[model samples]
Target: MKSFKRKAKIYLPLLMVGAVIGLLFTNCSKQGFDAAVAEIQKGDDPFLGYAWHINNTGQSVFATSGSGVVGFDLNMLKAWTSGLSGSGLKIVVSDDGIQDAHEDLKDNFLYGVSINYHLSTPTGANNAPPNSVDDNHGTAVAGLIAAVGGNGVGTKGIAYKSKLIAYNLLSSNVAQLDERIGQQVTGGYDIYNMSWGSSQNNLPVPVAVWGTSLVAGVTNGRAGKGSIYVKSAGNDFIVKCHNSTTTYCVGNANFDPDNNMPYTLMTGALNSMGEVASYSSPGANLWVSSFGGEFGDDYPAMITTDRSGCSAGYAQTLNSGKVEFERGSDGNSKCNYTTTFNGTSAAAPVLAGAIALILEANPNLTWRDVKYILAKTAVQVSPNMSNVTRHPFYNYPGDASKNVRLPTGAIWENAWVTNAAGFKFHNWFGFGRVNVDAAVALARNYSSPYTAGPSVIGFLMNSSPSPNAIPDYDAAGISSTLSVGTSLRIEAVQVQINISHNNIADLGIELISPSGTKSMIVNMRNSLTGIAGFDNDIFLSNAFFHERSNGTWTLKVYDGASNDITGTLNSWGVKIIGTP
Candidate 1:
């Protein structure tokens, strides 16, 4: 939430300014944009128009598909014509595996730097190519990031000219995965696109090494300019809540602890109609959002490279539930491309590609500069949505006679709040949907104030006040206050809690900044709702970014479920990363 001091409310005007600057700087005219669009319309790729993420004009992507909302795209046409196609940048796709020779992706693949960790030596020509249908993920993910463009090929990528390095970390050991995120054997990559997450929710993974790597990458990778790490906020919004057939959503972006890291830029998803995707998980940790269409069967989805040929992949001839394009019943007889790739998986790479374009615009920009540009230029969607609603856990099972409703009767979701720094944030969409055109324009003129960036071992303060008993099914939660003496601007905040409870999901945890900005880092009724509580588990939030850290900070934990069992707030600590 670093204050850009720019008028972010004038979003459309900012976009126009970006377009004008891009056109003027590249010496391209509006006719150039039109000519590029006309070339695509004349069938340069035969499917570019269907790729609504690049430029949405409400055209159906497949035979039986419905159209998306007009103008709800990445607005990349101007950026593309302005000579920003992510040239000279390198991206790492850490996932299952990739079809390196796929028609749409082969041209951009970086052979020498890629790795196949499943192999004995873990490096060579066979750099983790797809071995089965299950291994088709990385190929699609790669296509979203760097599939070749305007080559009279299949579809265009967001960063068409960016080089890609593939890694089969999904099939490798955890140590190798940790290395990929941290200091790699070949360690000069620019952006790391991670579309994977932990299956275990509300449980701590061994992220200490990965967390250290993330800090190092942002501070020291890419020749000291810092490497950008883009990750997918999980795709579990529609999952069933704990111990119930009812499909109540309990997914939060912070559930996967990897996303909680300040260095990790987590992105949520937007569907074809320019709304939050039904399956996109929501939390305070999300930085921004990008397109991840609905299932391609009924609506348009991402069109990207799949496994080679019809022998395997989602586009295989015999694959079930595929759309017209994927089944090869249409023009895709080779079955090389699939139109069914969708999720935060797709959304994350979209942001990564956008980051690539920003870097290409100005490679001198630091990691923090890139983040500031994005936050400054993001477009707020669903602006009219109410900021307060009846709390989701207000009606949880609790003895009416013994437990009373929480006094603060509302929960904040889908609502925008302008922090003290004049930066607006929302739980559903952090800053808002990324405006690539505006972001690129800002990046071109941006300079980093944080020349050295935040240190790896951030400033930490702990509060181990005497344990307090949390009321059962009551709104009156126990609160602990800590007075801080450190004076520094905030970049991100992390809170580690040790709580003892029968059912963890029944609890809600929030951090109230000295500025009175209340951020619910962990929500109630998550996947761990019926599980035992955590001890010393850490959660992070970006809601207080750019705010001062020299005031009183408060921690509140409450139980929402009606049960005889109660929980104890054992101890909690805080860590803040930013400038002094």
Candidate 2:
């Protein structure tokens, strides 16, 4: 409706794999190894082909200011972040509650909540105790979600316009965390990163009430104006098949991917092999996978910041300094301390951070809108792969229906994008790999049926206005400007005929816009509201009107059903008869 999006260069995070370094060399080499440019690897990883997308694409469009996280492409991240920063968004961090703010957070945090109970007496702010040890996790989470870029320091974030409002929500006890969330319905954080989910071994409620609270936090976030809660789909790593809420750590108590719930997103971890990590949780409810390769499964180059002392389990960070994760921080003989780590917990926040970047770019997006953009925007690793591959036994009469083909990946005879072996939507790989270009394109190309004008709007009644409507119209018929805007929907219904019109029933009404752009108003199936009585009228059902953006409009009604089809307009009444 309005071009208000912050200029954003959404850069995806550098790919981290716990797999063999040799594989990294191989994957990296695949770029130089491209003889014909295989589609399997779009190779948008800039390091291989073009210079970092930051310098190549959107440097001019955006101000190159700050950065933030988002579940999208790095090049797009470069574009998305720079643009948003140009739009004036700062950064904030929520490192282990109020007082224990870390370096990545300190001055960056925003205080959207002002509850007095948590405020420090002297400072007039909620200066909670500086539980430093556990602050690393939150700081790391902060960095990934909204790290400032181009400072010659750390990596940049996905969105530059996003500002952080860090409020640590981890509790020493799950119940307390849940209660606190209940109190902080607005959850303070525009993006709540719950990196830690209790093991099913520990069950305090019939179902995980904490997970419920997290979802509730997202709901409240929507109410709070603009917020998106991203939670790690837990580290259980099981094939979560059914959707149920049983007594124990219920198996199917999750959203169905085939039937996604209204709100909330659950992600899985993609190991370097591009296969679902054995440790990654699975089910029809799974949305997408983030990089969380097991130690040595992909990039062993990562450093998980240890926040053993803070209350909120962790805030993801760059494994460094006073806030570094020591080799022996676990206080146990079995801590498995190494740079190589694998857990859905590690991947979820990265995805969540990306969501934050998206929200920053488009603050008007509702949770549903956000979900739609993300899903619709994701580019399947292999756009032609399938999810399930049925063997010959499962084949009926040995025929496959294109309409009923399995999802993007995992198909019987993979023939969509041939030569590009492998199904992308396998049970393991949700919907191919997350392609940044595809996702952002989806967002940019999105055009909802938002009404552009108000009542009494003029329907120019012409394909392209001319001397017939306006004098001296055109030398090049393809391009012309009439009124220059489509609004004030010319309200009414008229008859429309089919393309197969060797018959006399060829009748219809043209919905000409103020700009002379025409959309035909025809009779069709009347399904729902604001549409029951106007079956044959110009319908604005999908018209997602921008609150107060639609301007005045006009309509040119005509007779098409059973008449000469030329005279039902009220232009004179709307203002055409010399002030009559």
Candidate 3:
């Protein structure tokens, strides 16, 4: 383990001075303008200009003073000014296209590294110009992670000093995504931020082909250490739907399986108040949460760079249904910026920026090392009893509610689970929100558990084939058990289930370890109405982190829907991968 005493010695003075400056600025409310000007003159960060979440104390003074923003309490900006900025790291944003020429993003842009895969013959250069309708999304995402800081211009980025490479992979073509992943691996990019995914209710199940390609990329990317993939959990939780004639809402975040892979770091969104964003997805796959503001009369969304002229973003749409261009002091049309960027799209980049800082603090840390430090240091917040429910679609009556019961008299609580060895986890918020100070500190001293030898040799522990039929609308369905013969420190758990049903979304699968810790592998995706059930589809979970592999592990497959949708547990198996 790294020495905390040595780390404290280097950063204590900087933290103390920053706190004093923060307090001084906080007390002199009237001099806020003068303080900002002085900071600009001293080449300090000017994030306080438009970022209201920094000091948002209440709804009344939201844009002025509060402790709710993502990086405020963590002192991430102070770390940036103290020379922990991502100077040598490379970050790539795989999205529609980025406006590399935006005043806030131009300086850190990596020339010749960007590619436009959307073109007929995918070119090497990023020719997607600014002010186009499709250019704003990537530009905003890039700005959150690598927009230039302390430049006396627009808002600052998380790792403003990091180099950015933009790839225009606009299509959902699996080949295009695989090609981009290949480029990131071969091109030596350290981190890849993906803030977009498939739309809600559209193929609400995981695609096996996509999952295989993603696993390969992450396992072999970054010259063997593996490139860090930061992905958004999605924004489908806000949609409302009904089964047949019953009314219900779709908040089961598990519907979007693109982020359920083990190698990727899945990020969810939190509002300024540190509460889960209404639209952010929830599931066991979520690894961490970050600030992606709420949209309403009281809550404001994220503020980032936008395309120039009068042809970009929601600001233009809100301005009399046309793109409206803001003019500078020189009376010339200028690039527009908006505070309407919300959802997991904005949250993923926030974590990516923080990851750059971690890499900058300790470049030797591996991809798994980063995940470990994040899981260990993330701060738990907002312990509401919302997650403890019968089912995600608990509002619906009849078939949905009959099979979605939790035992007989059991009540669910959104509680934090700390394993025997001390790793923490939460379903809705993952390991809670990211704490830059703690993550960076841990990263600096992190010693990889697999460093003693080659990466921990992962072997399949046991497998149980279930050929039994699962009854429809039955709370007590078919289960298979696998007994472990050897003791092992579990890291990743892979479950493959095969079933045949009209609506696979009505199935809820759970993995009960020998210790009785239940992991919801597949939740009831009400939006998925396809007849194709889980046909040898693999689902990975790290929720069982730090558990001892012994005794009999149970796999329960319950069919939660009625109305002629029935399935058989054709065959199910579990692969335990870890060190012994």
Best by lDDT: 1
Tens-place lDDT digits, model 3, residues 1-580:
0001111201000001112111212222434434433443325544334453333332212233322432332336555656887888888887657777778888989887676665665545755443245345778788888878778767777787998887755422324433454453334468988876654343344555656665566567666667788888776553434333233334444454565567788888876655666666666678888767655223446667776554564445334421122222112234356555666878888889899999889887777778878888888766443345464434333444423444332233345666655666676678777888778877777777754311232233333355467777766777777776655676667776777776776677878878777777666544555547766666666677767777788888777665556777776666776656
lDDT string, candidate 1, 58-171, tens digits: 655652534566677786667888988889999988776778888888899888767776567766544677654467778889888887887777778889899988877654
TM-score (all chains, Cα) for each model: 0.86, 0.46, 0.79
RMSD of each: 9.1, 18.5, 9.8
What lDDT tens digits, residue by residue, belong to model 2 across residues 195-270? 5443321112222343355456545655544455554554443221122222111111121111122234556665
lDDT values of the candidates?
0.71, 0.33, 0.61
* Error at 159, model 2, angstroms: 3.4
Predicted structure 3: lDDT: 0.61
Clashing pairs in 3: 55-65, 55-66, 56-65, 56-66, 57-65, 57-66
User: For this target, which candidate reaches the highest TM-score against the unseen true structure?
Assistant: 1
Q: Of the candidates numbered 2 and 3, which has the greater lDDT value?
A: 3
lDDT of 1: 0.71
Q: Regarding lDDT, does 1 or 3 come out ahead?
A: 1
Question: For each candidate, how many residue pairs have backbone atoms clashing (under 3 Å)?
Answer: 4, 84, 6
Where's the lowest-lDDT run of ten residues in candidate 1?
Answer: 9-18
